[model samples]
Structures are given as structure tokens and as C-alpha cells.
Target: MWVLVLFDLPTETRKDRQVATRFRKSLLDDGFSMFQFSIYMRFCASRENADVHARRVKKSLPKHGKVCIMQITDKQFGMIELFHGQKEIEPEKPSQQLELF
Candidate 1:
């Protein structure tokens, strides 16, 4: 599964910028990688793990902004088509994770 965090936070004031920066930093600290300017994604081994991260994202959300969290199966994510200009590019493949009990 993949957890995608998309947000549009205000940055007009210094405090607003600080809050936006902190939110982005928190996402990175929580293992999400930048997919686009406003999109971050993290790969999870299960739905439960994804939910955990989603909750964390919610907890760190800015007071004034729009944020969206989405979960998609590996198959669905793999079907995404990317492009640079008019040239097509392959989407990144998810790394295999090893879990130990």
C-alpha cells in the first residue's frame, strides 16, 4: 500500500511559512518522499501501517490549510504514468520491505 499526502498551506506570513515548513518537515521525518511540490508518498506494508502514518499526518496538519490523505494499492500505484515534457517516463517502483518479527 502507498500513503499519499497532498496539501495546500498558506505561506503569506512568516508564521504561516514556518508552519508550512514544519508540516513538510514532519512528513519527511515520518518517511514520506516528495512526489511533487505538494504531494508526498510513503510505502507501507499494510493498511494498518498506512493508517498509522495517516493519523500522524493529521496530527501535524497546519491550522489553516487544505490537506488530503489517500491510500492506494501497489497495483494501482504502479499503473500511474509519468511524463517529463512530452516524453513519457516510468513511475518509480516501490522498494521491497523486509519485516522481522
Candidate 2:
């Protein structure tokens, strides 16, 4: 299985950068690869590896920040790669639609 870990912090201050670096190192030590900024993709051999990595990351993040883990299938990974190859498209509408009677 593949796990995608995304993280967000309050700001990109020096302290935040340090924390992020440490977090990345920790993930690398646990055998995760960087997929994007603040996102890590890992190929886990078993559920135990994923669980351990999750727990370690949860414990390592700052109190003011957040980390999210999503398990992605091989098909999803391929879709992600395909999507990455194309330019981003804007939404059709700029404002929310309203209904009135």
C-alpha cells in the first residue's frame, strides 16, 4: 500500500522550517519519499509499518500544526501522475450559485 502524508503549519517561519526539516528527516528514516511540498508518499510493506509511521509523525508534529495521512491505491497513484502532467484548470464559475423563488 501507498500512504500519502500531507502537513500544514501556521506559518513558514524559522521555527516552522526547523520543525518541517525534522519531520522530513523522521519520515525519511521511516522509509518515506517526498512526493510534494509538505506531502510525503510511502510504500508500506505492511499495516504495521504504516501504523508505526503514522504514530511517529503524529507525535512529532508541532502542537499548532496538523498532519494528514491518506492511503492511496496504485490506480490512484497513476491518476495522480496523469493529473500532474496537465495544467490546472480554473473553476467554471467565480461566485456561488444562488436560487430564489
Candidate 3:
């Protein structure tokens, strides 16, 4: 399974920018990879693990902006199509198989 987080936080004030930057750092520290600006994804071993990460994301969400957490199976995540500008780009591969839990 995969845990995907999408967020948009106000960055007008210095404090707001600091908060936003801290939130992004938290995601990386929690093992999420940046999928795009304000978007992050992490692979989990199971739905339970994904839920744990989803709740973590919820807890770190900024008070000023909207945040969304979604869970998808490995197959569904793998099915994603990708493109960069006018050229196609390879989508992210799922986590290595049979990783020691």
C-alpha cells in the first residue's frame, strides 16, 4: 500500500513559510518521497501501516491550509501514468518486494 499526502499552506508571512517548510521536512523525515511541490508519497507494508502514516500526516498538517491523505494499493499506485512537460517520464516503482518487516 501507499500513503499519499497533498497539502497547500499559506506562505505569505514568514511564520507561515516556516511552518510550511517544517511540515515538508517532517514528511521527509518520516520516509516520504517528494512527488511534486506539496505532494509526497510513501510505501507501506500494509493498510494498517498506511493508516498510521496517514494519521501522522494529519497530525502535522498546518492550521491554515487544506491537507489530504489517501491510501492506494501497490497495484493501483503502479498503474499511475506519468509525463514531464512534453516528454514522458518513468513513474516511481513500488518498494522492493519482500522487504523485511
Residue pairs in candidate 3 whose N, alpha carbon or C atoms collide under 3 angstroms: none
Query: Model 2, residue 15: what's the lDDT?
Result: 87
Candidate 3 lDDT score at position 49: 83
lDDT tens per residue, model 2, 77-96:
55542234576533222123
Q: What is the overall TM-score of model 3 with all chains considered together?
A: 0.90
TM accuracy, model 2:
0.67
Q: In candidate 2, list every pair of residues with a backbone clash.
A: none
TM-score of 1: 0.95
Q: Write the per-residue lDDT of candidate 3 for residues 1-101, one digit (tens) a residue.
A: 98989898999999999999999999999989999998899999989888888888888888898888889998988788888888888886766757664
Measure candidate 3: CA RMSD. 1.7
Best by lDDT: 1
lDDT, candidate 2, at 2: 68
Candidate 3: where are CA atoms >4 Å away? Answer: 95-101
Off by over 4 Å in 2: 83-101
How high is the lDDT of residue 43 in model 2?
65
Q: Each prediction's TM-score against the native? A: 0.95, 0.67, 0.90
